[model samples]
Target: ATLPGEQLFEQFTKGLELVFGDKPSLGFICGIKEAVREDGATLPGLCCIDAPYQLDEDYWGSEYQCEVDDGLGSLIPNPCERISPYFGKISEESCKVYGGTYCPLTDCTRLQECVAELIDIARNENRTAFANYLLNAPNITDPENSFQCGWAREYFGFPANFINDNQICEDIKQFRNSRDFEFLEEFFNQGSSSDEPGDDDDNFNVVPPLVLVPPDPENRDATEAVSKKAEVQNGQAWRATNFALESAAKTLNSIYDAIKDSKCPCGGPFCVAGDICKLVQNIAQKITVVGLILIETSAEISKFTYGEVAELGNVEPIQTGERVKAIYDNMVLTGNYLQRRFQGVNDYLERMENRLVRALAPPSAPGPAPETVASPSNPNITFVVRNGVGCDGLDQDGDSVEDNCEEDRFPPSLRLTSKASTSFVCEVDYCLEERFRTQTEAITFLNAVFDVVDDCSAPEFVQKVIEQIPGTVCEKTRFEIIPVQTFPENSTCADVTLPGISAIVELGLDTSAPTVLCGFQVDRSDDDRRVSPDSKTLVIPSERKSSFVDTLLFQTTADNCPGPLRRMVTVQSNEFVYGTNSVVLINQENTEDGSVVPRLFVNPQSCADGSQDDATICDPDPVSDFRFYEVKISVTDAVGNEAVDTCRVIVEPSRRRNLAKQTKDSQRSSSESGKGSKKIIPIEELLLKVAESNVRYTLATVTSEVSPSPVA
Candidate 1:
């Protein structure tokens, strides 16, 4: 349901008015509602209206004749007088709300005097002094804080009700009462200074430096010491990322210079063919800009971390922790990625320079040997050489052994691989124990490292500019461990005590994405239980049904990273039937004929098998003169949520048994032959005879029989 065009315009005008002010004019926008004269007479539609207005009450709204210049270059006279009082008019107060200085004509005497003093004060005084003066002025009421006005009351202070409710006072109060008052104050105080000291050209266009404001202690739930330490760590991470960007910038500039120096026109000794030089130059420029944009993105991301970092100490912390952790992780990962890219480009340029030198060298002498630029390796990571990896000739690990060679001496370890086949073995022994802890602080430091072995390098440049360095194929195994209860919360021998009775459930996981390796650590009061070899499935004997409740702990490897242990609870009951909703009567005999019929129970067949000697009742004495028993069935999910339904079972005699009892008469008597007992031939068969005489006789006999009944 969408609002009509007029209604939508009215609502939008109302909201805009709340943000700015009613009756404030700026070009097309006039008053929030329809314009009216001083006598309360409504003005005509848009074309006839005079929209320009002033604060002075003597300036009564009026209508004026007008003409519009159509785009086709002809002046068309308006059909009606324009009565709107705000077209093309600008409001000084609205301009101030938008952070623009508004200068009005001196001829507007009343408004000039009214706002002249405040305008002078704003220009002469600093923001703090002006805000203080507004807040503490006499005859001015403090701003209201009522929440009924929505964000207007929350983000901005209520307008001060000064003498006569001057509009300027409200704007001042809003500034003083805003949540961003401190930021605005800092902007006004320090943002005005010249970029280079002692040189003042009034370059007000310069954006202010980013200021990090520590959140309130109440929000963070941290001691003063811990808060200070977190701040220090935050600053350090930022500086390190900034330094990486700076180095990247320098490398891009150097690359750009080298490309420019190598460029030459065609037919020259050093000339490069085609657009290769132009292409390389373009790539260098794009990469430089990309680095710059990343730096800006890093700054923007830092701002989002304030509230997220504070949310770490909240009782429910996973979502916030993941968000903040991603920031730190991305920073580190991007730093490493940039380092790899810069190094690759530098190595390419060095080789090109050496090639040029060889080309210019004397033909009698051989070219110098190319330098072997080894790939940089992280200290936190270990490497292993394996067989049948990519690019058989290259030694990626610098071990002088090709990755495809089978006789590698390195030991097998957990390897983290990227989409590009860049593999490294990361041994973070502590991450396994602490990664899944509910406490965000447990993994904060490690998450900040970014280089912590994970699948962070899955995204790669698709363009040819990205070097296609041959990398080793990574061989690593990862699995997710899930603990599953083999039975319901409360169950007897029928559920799991029987052989081959184990609860199987799907956890609704993406089985195709990650391998699931399941195992369990069971803790139960009963000793009479059996566990599967993998420790994932548990079974308890019928005798130990009463105490089969167990807690199972599980651990898993989260693809290229360490995950924490998870716990699941399993329960069993001594009772054969877990619950009974109600007793229902099912007649065992047909009411009309007193015929007996047998019915089967819907519950587990074992519950009705009396030979098992379980608590489940099959046929009980008449309850209210009806012989019946209750059959209960229940289903539970992997997470222990359950639904149960029950029905009554009635017992009766079998109808088949009654029908089998009827005996057959064995005696038989001989009978004498008679005309009435003789078989009679049909008239139609007699008519089919081939002889004409016999056919006529049969027809005559049929006609006589019919005539005897009636002459029809």
Candidate 2:
């Protein structure tokens, strides 16, 4: 017979295959077995054995009844009777030995009770044991069983079961070595021991060893070494790759530099090395062939050419190719190319080399020639002036001699004549007699004479002579005289005249012929005399008039008059005199001697004294100078030329010492008469009284005339 534990274990294994598949790991499968074992009694329990065969009614008595007992007494039977009853019955002695003296039925009842109690104990103990087992279980490694039976999988749906077998064990080992697991185990064990009922030292009980595993030092060392080697290998690979790239770049740079620096026989540095070398070789071959040809041709040309035409005038022939090549070689070595053509090289180099050769070579010499000097061979004709004569002199007729015969005459003559043979004589008296080839020469001679005597200073006679010479004189030749005149003192007059007087006096001018006098007067004065009060001469105070003269003189020239001739005249009166009985006419021309014949006459009867006095008094001429005698003279020329002249005489007061004296007796008589004349009124008072009397008489006359006739 199978034990319940074993049967349940089998059932769980089968269920796991159906639910989770595969044989689970031992730890998790064990946990599942324990859970099932604890709950085994609760799952509807199965019978241990099948039921017995049922009895048929044919084999039983017709009246047989199926009675059943409520307890084990009915299920068990008595076996003491020896009557050979049915095969199912047992004797009483057999019942006592097999079931006990209580009978089979009672024994059977007791056995059933014991089995139920054992089942109850097994379930309760298994549940507690299963929980403990799972808490302490090792990690499961099987995928299916771990997923189906682990606490996390069972309660939640965590697929801890999905962890690979090796990884699960690794984690489990890591957890076991952790301090947390160790602490948990120690703490739980101590608590379990403390809960023991009768143990005094249980609190101090030693905890079981926790299953914490220590790390494997050998594996750790192996892992570190492997990781370090991998990192170093990777670094080395990167460095090697970078170095390879750098080397490649350097190689490329060198190639570029070589190409850039290389010179090509062609124009530029664009060709590769192989191309440049080929070009150089080909050029050399061509140059060699050209040099040979040039040399042969040059020899032939030299044989035929010679002299100046070949050397200078003609273009020189270029040598053939071979000769040119030979020259190029020689020039490359010694640098000379006088007779060669340049080709197959750098263009600039060819040009430069040619220029150098030309510069270094000597120049060619010139051919021969002739020389002479030039001069003139004829003498120029010249003319000379005789006397004042020149080429322009007049001859009146076509004859060359001047017509007029004066002692200082300029004899006309002709030296050079024009080829036209036309001759004419100058008719002018002062003409130049010498002939001139050019008018400019004649003009130059005349200008010299003009410089000596210009028109403004030349004499008028000389100007007239020049003007009357027909066309012989230059129009610009004329004479002018500037008169500078000064007038005589007191000779100027305005409204009066004197015999033998001219309006304008000629000075330093030609008076041999009549001429008009015209010019402005400067600094003129009308007074006859100028007085300096500081001098002893008495000044006659009077208003006088005078003017400048611009006049014409008939039949006379300015030379007849003296230098600084008087052009005007003035008349003036003497100063006032005082205390004279009568004004006298002294000499008007000589005031100091008073001896001139009087030109003025006045009757003394016309004066207040009615006396014929010869002197004037200040009382008679108080308004001005006391010249009482005035003479007015009328002049008539012998040819009926008429004019007037006036003279004045002044008589001044007598000195006080020259007065008549009175006698002493006469003075006494006059004093007495003055005393007796008190009754007589003074003349001024008598005049006043007479004026008042006249005024009253006139008033009475006016009143009577104005009033009505009294009682007519």
Candidate 3:
């Protein structure tokens, strides 16, 4: 019913499905067959089985004998003649040409032999049982068994080669190249050898009528030797695989250990293990430095007393020396830590290299030697030294040895003295042969030296000496008293003006001994005059006077002076006192109000005594003989002590004129009385009219009588 090609296609599709689990689509099966054909291979053949309809023993016996004779006669000329006669005969011509008898009977005989051997192999715990079963049953083409053959063919492509070889023994050599042979070889190597046949065996007594002899012993022994060699090679391969796996694991562990011990390049506190620790420390250090600078600068600006004169700019609050020190400390810590971490990383890297070398090389070969690693002990991280100022006392030759450690040398001791005035002297004991780069720098260095001393000194003596120095030292050397002013119980100059009050401080440079003074001067005006009479004159030692004067002149005030009185003081001889030449001048002409009345004045005539050329204005007594006629009154409140009132006496001539007119009108009315009922205007009304009339007259006289036209 079907064409040869069509029938072949159908049989191939059915056979593939039975062997490989499921039937693919017709097109897919056709494609697979086409692919096989393209590669010079043929699809597997399929066969069907049908049961015998009826069996007559006598008849079957005769027919079977005839078939056996027919098959034997057909195989008589074949090279495998020894086993051919065992096949039952079929049509003589069909058997001879197509060998149907040998094809079917040989396959059945092989299956029986394989099954028996497999049972024996299994009972003996032989791993080669499965391999031997496949080998012996090579012609069993039942679909179930064929499916396993197909699986092995697809997996290793060996059974396909065996089939292509037309079942020849030579094909086994080609099939052995497949990966399946490796499994087969491993299985066979682990199996026990087959037992030798004995004369006592009953199976040997009943021989088949047609028997097939086994292969030659020489060929069998050669095959067995090849199998043994493969087994030995497989064991060596497994050992190599294990060695590679272990070496890789060791290398990975070494790398992990190195990373764990390695330090971070950016340093602070080692917080590598904790999350974001390095970032937090970095931010904290930056904030601390910035906060210190801001606080110090604010303190310096608060020293000014007067609201007007203190408005001068360039008064910074931070102590430059302290700021530099803070920066230096942070940098040192960071740099030192980084150096250490770098060393550790380098060491780790070397160890990692060694591990890699060992992994790649043989165990007997020596590994490359590890390199020596080093870390910096002290990385001198310092601030930018400006013009020989704020040197950290480490410059030996005054050459600004900020970058190099070789040039660094300790500075000499600085001595400071506070006098009765509000200014102090800072003296350097070092040789003057090493000249300062600039006068400003010299002043700054000296002031900083004093500040360092003051910061570490006793609290009682700190304020007395610190208050002597004016605020205007160098920008980098100014020391500010925090919170503007503080009142400690044991202060010596509590009642004195703000300019005279000293602040006690420690420079924080050293903990061993007091080395310098950080003096603060209250008065900033050029016209230096003592605010208090009881204040004493301040003096500096002749040698250190220049440093004291320079620092005093540069310090500025926060607010300008409000009233005529200017507070002035100086520090000298370890004391804070009022300045000698300070003057309080009134500048009310520049006030917002147009009034020219002098708010404050010192009468030269009143103050003059026969003793001194300069007149002294002492505290005035309200009940004194001094006249208050021209003096304008200024009232100040107690709380802020700020001026709250301004009072001036004004004599009105218009009121006098109105009074005269009212008197004249009252007299005239009295004389005209009794004759007519007098019109009596109330005294208040009369006074109002007279006042209005006088004002109008005054305006007219000024406009028309004094100047015919308004003055340009």
Candidate 4:
């Protein structure tokens, strides 16, 4: 008549009893339920038991057919197999209702592998924090070799024993005498009861309490009696403190495990954002709970015999006050370690949040606009200079007011262009005169001022503009713009000499960046061509007696009249080498003379065997029909102004002219003439010129002779 769910719960309880032969504490039962919930398992609910039940796989093989390889050669029960029996009858539909699904065992294996990797990463991070902070070790310059930073055995690799081993920032002698460490060591110790101090009559029992192991039915009552007597002798307050310490130790272990489990186990280049968010939430919640438990336990421990209330007690504390202080300090240090871990999680979450915001931000909502705005009437106009008063001459519009007279309603527009060859000049005087003599004059004045300053409305220029006119305000000035003759580079005009009051003004300074000139020698043939007159494009034949040499000329010009220049060239292909002996050197000499134009010598092949050097040999035939190399040239002037230009060098495949035969024939002819054979010197030696030399040399001709008859 009982319900099926109730039957399952009854069976589960009976199984526990059969193993331990006694009713377990309510906390122990609840602990199991909590573990099941944390593991994310669900099953048919009974009021007493919400956790799912696993079928006896050994007895019921057909119902739980699914098995996974344990990474070893052995197969083990998979989650699907383990959860199948909770449904009473296994079915894909029923299993999926509780979030279970049948999948290849390999999928489960991969998940486990990923989890193992995350656990390893978590352990490494924890080791680093422990080494750097808790141990008070030197800063880790290299994280990969930081193991030596802490106690050698405490953070030793694998099967972590950090919490189990001795670890405190201070000296071991001091730590051993500390009260906080006494409780910690005793709580986590795995040794049997014999290792503890003797428990005889008249002796106070300070040993940490252990869960009672179920004895034989005949001895059960007696075992409980002894445990009860011991608790009474110790005093209930002392017993409560010990229990709290025990709970605290367990909680610490849980925290360590939680850190390992909280990491997302996706083993791909990127994980799902939702999964990462879930991982962040899970870790934060776990840490929060663990922190609360430690705080509560420490509070409980502080209220003990040797704690704050020790003076109020009738009996003196069994332990010393130093022990309490030690416990408190150790708790603080534990919190420090936990805080380090929390900070890592916090940083990772912040980075993820920033990335999410950037990726999800709306594209239509652009950032704020810049300060400057172009005139509505003419986009080219950079500024509009307005005068409070305007108007000049007799009326041409046939109105009561003179045509070019009376206050003008609007300001004149200023346009800057790159067309002018001379500096612009502007005149500023009060009145119904004119803002500009002509529109072209306004444009030229704008060009000059703009070249000197980026913004006319800037703070530095505002005062300068006000002082330019004699007793004339910026708003009242007329003939605002005029043309001025160009001065030498770096020169500025001073002191306004207009027929007016004294006004000091400075104008016309060159600050613009220099320009670089790049050119290449042109070649014309079936294998080479100059499609355009510009130096930007050129074709050259690869076939040559020794190596092909191409001259790349460079020049740099700055506004401050040409000065000493530094030139650098970079070829964007493996087919070319530059400078002396394949080493590019920057010019070090200081000279303004134009005769020494900075030149870059490029040799496609510098050896007779068509090699760039002794180490690299090029194929007698080109690798491809045509290869294009981009040559980038940069130049810097004495004033630090820099410019860069690029040109394309196209290389045609070699034509195989049989130069060896020609050389042999030439050598024979020279010998027959009784001139003797000329030694075949490498052409690269002739082409490789000293970089500092003033003179230049070119290989215009190459001749060799071949003998027709043997020289007996």
Candidate 5:
């Protein structure tokens, strides 16, 4: 930045002096030079010393014209049309790092200052004085001897990377590279160049200052406290373990003293074996004591200060810490030793017990098994399993193992079978049974229908009937209408767990970006166990089997399910109900990428039974005895606020065949002669009461004056 009347001519000349090392070098920039007289027309100075100095030399203007008159036009003509040839004649000592000096060393910084000062001088003060000197400037004796320079373009922040290999750009790069100036370090450390394509004017990308927090005062002793507590636990655990081992050893010795003298059946030579056999029973009892000790010791350790920690309170902290570590190492060894010893003693006892039990037990008898003919009508066609009845210690039923330790031949499994009457393979069982009411005198027998859904994720609508008895009902039931919920309860932001239904929002796919799929957590009461959000086992049955959007895989987020509980469950995002009136389970899992991905428990398995290799998810030929499912549940809160509710779910006829609707249709049809529910209506029952009163009056009249009292 130049200013008015700042002596710009001498300043830029001084920059040339430093670059060329005090030598009288030719001007590197055409635009700035002291003017002088021409060769043929000299005044006082050799070229143009008496003329005013100029800061800007327009190649097309009088300054260049004067240069031509002075016979310097051949060397410095029209710099815009062709850069000054002096650009290719940079001094060997100039700063040369690359093709251009966009941000050169401090030497170039000072030169730029000089050039900038003259720019202002040309505009505000002594403009003509500078202009006169610029024209008719003396030509250099050797154009190749001009000082190399680039400060003007770099200081002005013009792009130095011209995208071409021009001579001026090449000269600037070489001049800057030739220097090893430490003063240029600041420019190199800058994050970006001013001429970069996307650099912002404000340079907002500069590094921010760091912040640090002072350590907490309490934290100074926190590590020592934790270490001390762990030491106390170790000491307590060691002492308890030792006591258990000592007690076991004492009991074994006492038993050995008693058993060695009495057992003498093999006194000839193998009597020692008899004595060892006698010790087997006592050893088994001692092993049980060791197992009990392990459980009790672990339970004691969890009792806070009352347990092992209390026992270690009097010990010195340093000594206790070292002893704790030593005891911990020894505990592992002791545990392994006792376990191996127990196994040996238990094995010997088992062999002796097996021999004695087998000798006393009678010959084994096999029980009769019910025969099955593989009839589809038989609900119990599947095999039944029961534990075998054999001598307690010996192997039975030809398997090479003790009966008590026999391995079950079969695992618990399910098989889908078909019914005989309907050749269609049964995927689900639906049964209804009728019963006449006997206990209730006021109510008549009616078929009560109960429609129910088992899964809560996507509920199937069911219609149920209650007897409507004139008494206090014992049960209350409520099914949540909305399972996938996302709503705040108050002015403050709340966890996404609203009881009301969730508002539906439009969903779109962003295939341009990939994301993890996840869903929201269900609102369960605090006591209710939460199924892992990661391995979401819930299902929302849908009518169509389509993509994620179509499959209804959207829910609000929940915080309880974090870490491993929050997982990325990926599978088919389609819901395949396929239009059968059966259960629908759309297993959608919450994934990490904030997307809902559907997971399948059974894939390539059709809901339709008997489809080839189809693993059906329903019971075949299941006998569900339809009775009124009545249960009473009492809910008592912490404050003893109690509520008792009894719910009775029974099957009811469809709405079209409802009792009230049937009665209405019957009454309407009666005007044209027709039928309906024979159950007594209020109006008909009243009319029948009046008719019976009249009949009683007539009978009284036939019996003479005995009918005098009006049948009220």
Candidate 6:
């Protein structure tokens, strides 16, 4: 549970200065209100703390007075004063007692800007790591936006509420009762968070405020009762979350059932509904898994028989926060996708309904019959074809010419081709006869537009572009995203060198990408050959972290390209093969040159956890006779040109931990050979001893019984 934004920041900032022994030069999350982002989606509250605002020290400090103006508990300073500027290096006074240094962040504005950039980068992943960095960053000018420092928490005292029973003195309790503690109970003690969260979302989520008031040490019963109550409450909340997740899963299954049971003329495995059901099932299963993880993580926070909130301690409140964040993020993504899908389904159903309504309509009495010609289309009514782009085999442009003419080539640079043209507008309109039946439609035309379809048929971008297009005749619009591939000419796969580090490094990406008339292909390699399940190379989707090929970067030089795709280096190794995360022997002799005019790539696969799976390939320790692997890199340009090359990877090797232990064992064996060593005892002797002991035990039992009778 957390307090409102303003109150949360106040407490957090107070903890920093009051507990951590500093003048508090950070934390300016002032305004808490809903903010809309550029994408038109309304997110959480915006915290424009970096922007200049009138500092209201009196408002927060209020009449609630404290005995001392000291520590993080000191009055909130002016907006500018919230940050202290320093330059050059960390001063000795700024260093931690045990010795940790931080470059003073004197320029508050610059620091905030840098921090914001970091937060943006983290929005997609691992925000906790960035938060930890900001919590204890060194004072330094962040021109490049990289701030990292290590310091022990011991350097700063725990917050007043965070301190244990022994640490809280009567004087401190009295001071807290009179001052800062008032706000923790009443959220703001003044105002609440903004209901409309903006683009600059600052976790405006409302949670139960902390009920912090030191218990009477002498009143043991009251303390135990409070502790028990808290334990039960926390457990209840956790259990409720689990129950909600189960309910959601059941609901999704129910939805899938409805979709499955729906009538469809076509029948194969699951008809048209199977794909949707599969997607929903995947999301439901994952949601359940993440929910279970969230519950388990929250439960592990305390093993206390009763309860305690003495300090943050090993209690990873951040993890709990992140788990919620992950859940929300996944749920949002899945919900959005499902919504779009259902919307498409609704549109199709609506079209069908309109058709049926038209079919059943009453005819006009004694209308004049117009002269009609026996044409392929319905000649009863005059029809003029509208102009539009086309890729499918039909005169979509309304020109007398058939499929050969692609009137408005999109990607304007895409040329007409005999086969595999990937240039089509997101949506286009053309006049058609009422007699036209959807069943007569080609697989690509019907499947690609307004229906869940294959990538080649519809592609990912078509729907996006189509949605953005306005003022279109809804009945005639056709959507498709096509990127045509042309044969490559004079193309060369450049020799590239990548940084050999545990960190992800891009291979000479800027210079090494395939250069052709059209765009190129870049993919991860495996076994000295280009990584491709089919003839077409896999296109890298997004930037990812890896020791080797993170993604295959594909670019089309045609008039239309979907912006630049970022690439991350995949850690290549030989040992961590076949998805096994274990130390294993390397095949030193399996070296092959896959340079057939076609390039070989050394694309190594990674474990789900993003670690190099092959322990033998990239061993970190020094060992003699290191083995190298080859990878084939190949690219087929937008124009039918193809180029391939082979690259070698020098995988670092390590002697397994067993080597040192084995050496010690050998030395001990040699030493023991000269000294007296015990011989191995046979099992027959042990069996005889066991038999003798059993007989003695029987005799003793009888004697004891007889002796006991003497008392009687």
The prediction achieving the highest lDDT against the true structure is 4
RMSD of each: 36.9, 69.1, 43.9, 33.8, 46.5, 41.8
Candidate 4 per-residue lDDT, tens place, 1-712, comes to: 1011122222233222111101111212232233222221222111111123334434343333445577799867554322322321112333443344432211122222332443354245332222112232223333223242222212221111111111111122232333323333333232224444753211123342222122335755554555444432223434444444444444444433443343222211122222323433343344435444544555455444223222322222243333443443333323322333334434444433333333222333343321121212212211111121122111112222321222222222233334433323544221221233233443345445432211111222212122233343222332233322121232222222112122322232223344665666555333234423665655444444345444544433433333344655565542333333432223323345323343344444423334334555432213333334555666554334456787655443343223333444568888788664534323232122211223222211111111111112
| lDDT by residue (tens digit), candidate 1, 602-705 | 22112222322244343322212112223232322222222333322221112211221221111111133221232222223322221222111000000000
What's the lDDT for candidate 4? 0.33
TM-score of each: 0.18, 0.13, 0.15, 0.20, 0.12, 0.19
User: What's the lDDT for residue 187 in model 6?
Assistant: 26
**Residues 404-498, model 6: lDDT tens digits:** 22322322111222332233432222222111112223223322332222211223322211121222222332323233322113212112111
Return the TM-score for candidate 2, rounded to 2 decimals: 0.13
C-alpha lDDT score of every prediction, in listed order: 0.29, 0.25, 0.26, 0.33, 0.25, 0.26
In terms of lDDT, the poorest run of 10 residues in model 5 is 697-706
Candidate 6 contains a number of clashing pairs equal to 55
1 or 4, which is superior by lDDT? 4
Query: What is the C-alpha local distance difference test score of candidate 5?
Result: 0.25
In angstroms, the error of model 6 at 525 is 89
User: Global CA lDDT of candidate 1, please?
Assistant: 0.29
Judge candidate 6 at residue 692 and give its lDDT: 37
Per-residue alpha-carbon lDDT of model 2 for 227-323, expressed as tens digits? 4444321233223323332332333233223323333221112222223233322333332333334333333332222111112112222323333
Cα TM-score of candidate 3: 0.15
- Between the candidate structures 2 and 5, which one is better when assessed by lDDT? 5
Better of 4 and 6 by TM-score: 4
